[model samples]
Target: MQVLIANHGAYLSGIATTLWLCLYSGVLTLVVGTVIAGFRVSPLTPLRAFGTAWVTVFRNCPLVVVLFFMAFALPVLGLNASYFVFGTVGLALYTSAFVCEAIRSGINSVPAGQAEAARSIGLGFTQTLGLVILPQAVRSIIPPLGSVLIAMIKNSAIAGAFGVGGDLYMTGTRLSSAQGEAVVPVLIGVALGYLVITIPAGLLLGYVERKVAIAR
Candidate 1:
C-alpha cells in the first residue's frame, strides 16, 4: 500500500538488480555446468575425477560458506572485486553443481545406442556429444534446468544479506528497519517482486516443456 507506493522506485531498482544477478549467474551456471558435465562423461579418467570432485565439493558445501569465501576470503588474497561480482560468481559456482548433475542425468537418459551409432559413423567423442547426444538430451534437461534456475532466483536474495545490496531483500530490509515502514506491507511488496520474476519463468518453462514433450 503506502509502503509500496512510497518505495516504488526503490522496488523497481531492486527488481532490476535481482534480474542482473540472475542473468549473470544463470549464464555462468549453464556454461560451467556444461563443461563439468562433459568432463564427467569424458574418456579421460583425470577429467572425470576432477568433475566428480567439483560436484561433490560445491554440491555438498553450504552456499553461505561459499559466498562467504568469495566475498571475504578472496579479497584478502588480492582478488578484490565488488560484492556484486562476488555474489554473482558464488551463486553461479554453487548452482553450477546442481546444473551439472541435472545435465549429467540428461546425458545418462540418452540412449547408448545413439552414441554407438554416431561412433560407428566415425564421429569423434566431442562430435558425438555436441551434435547428437546433447541435442537429444536437451529435452530432458530443460525441465530440471528450469527448476534449478527458479531456485537460483530465490537464492539470490541471500546475496543481498551478504553485502550485495540493491536487491529486493535489501530493499525490504531498508524499508522496514531503516525507514520504519510496517513490516507486513513491505514484505508483501517484496513477495510480489519475487513473484514477478518467478511466476513468468515458471509459466514459460511449462510452455517450453510442453512443446518439447510434443516434439519428442
Candidate 2:
C-alpha cells in the first residue's frame, strides 16, 4: 500500500496518457477504417484492390514490427517523429485494418435492395452510401466497433516497449524495476484500469445496439 500510494502520481499520469493515446488512435482508426471500407466496397476495381491490399498487409503484419518500422525505418527515410507520435500513428493504422473489416461486414449486412432503392430515387453513389446504406450499416456495427475500441485500448500498452513515456505499461515496468518487487500489483492495476474503461464502453454499445434493434 505504501508503494502504491507513493507512486500514485506516476500511475495516474501513466494511465491518463495511455488513455488519451488510445482514444486518439481509436478515433483516427475509425475514420481511416470507414474510408478504407468505402474504397473496398467501391465499384472501381483498382480502388477495391488497393484497399484490400492495405487491409491484408496491415492485418497480417505483427504490430511490433509496424512500430519498429515507424520508429526506425521511417526516421531513416526522413519521416522523423517523436516516439509517442510514431507509436500512436502506427497503432492507429494497424488497428484501422481490423476496424475496416468489421465495418465492411456491417456494410455487407445491409440489403442490396437498399442501394437499389437509393439509385432508383436518382441518388448518386456517394449520397446513397452516405444517407442510406451507411446509416443502416451503422446500426449493425455498434457492437463490433465497440470491440475494436476495446482492443485499441489494450494494445496501447505496446507503446511502452517503443519508449513512449507515461503509458501505463511503461510505468508498471519502471515501478517493478525500481522497487525490485514482483510486478503483480502493477500488472493488476493496469488490468483493472483497462477494464474500468472498456467494460463500460462495451455495455454502452450493447445498450445502443438494443435500442437500434427496437427502432428497426
Against the true structure, whose lDDT is highest?
Answer: 1
Cα lDDT tens digits, model 1, 175-199, are 9999899999999999999999999
| Candidate 1 Cα misplacement greater than 4 A, ranges | none
TM-score of 2: 0.94
CA-lDDT, candidates in order: 0.95, 0.87
lDDT of 2 by residue, 1-216 (tens): 666677778888887888788878888898999999999999889989999999999999999999999999998999988888998899999999999999999999999999999999999878988899989998888878888888888888886689888788888888889767557877776676677777887888888889998998
After best superposition, candidate 2 residue 38: deviation in angstroms? 0.3
TM-score of each: 0.97, 0.94
Q: Give the runs in model 2 whose Cα sits over 4 Å from its true position.
A: 179-181
Judge candidate 2 at residue 207 and give its lDDT.
Answer: 89
Q: Least accurate stretch of 10 residues (summed lDDT) in model 2? A: 181-190
Query: How displaced is residue 14 in candidate 2, in Å?
Result: 1.3
Q: What alpha-carbon RMSD in Å does predicted model 2 have with respect to the real structure?
A: 1.5
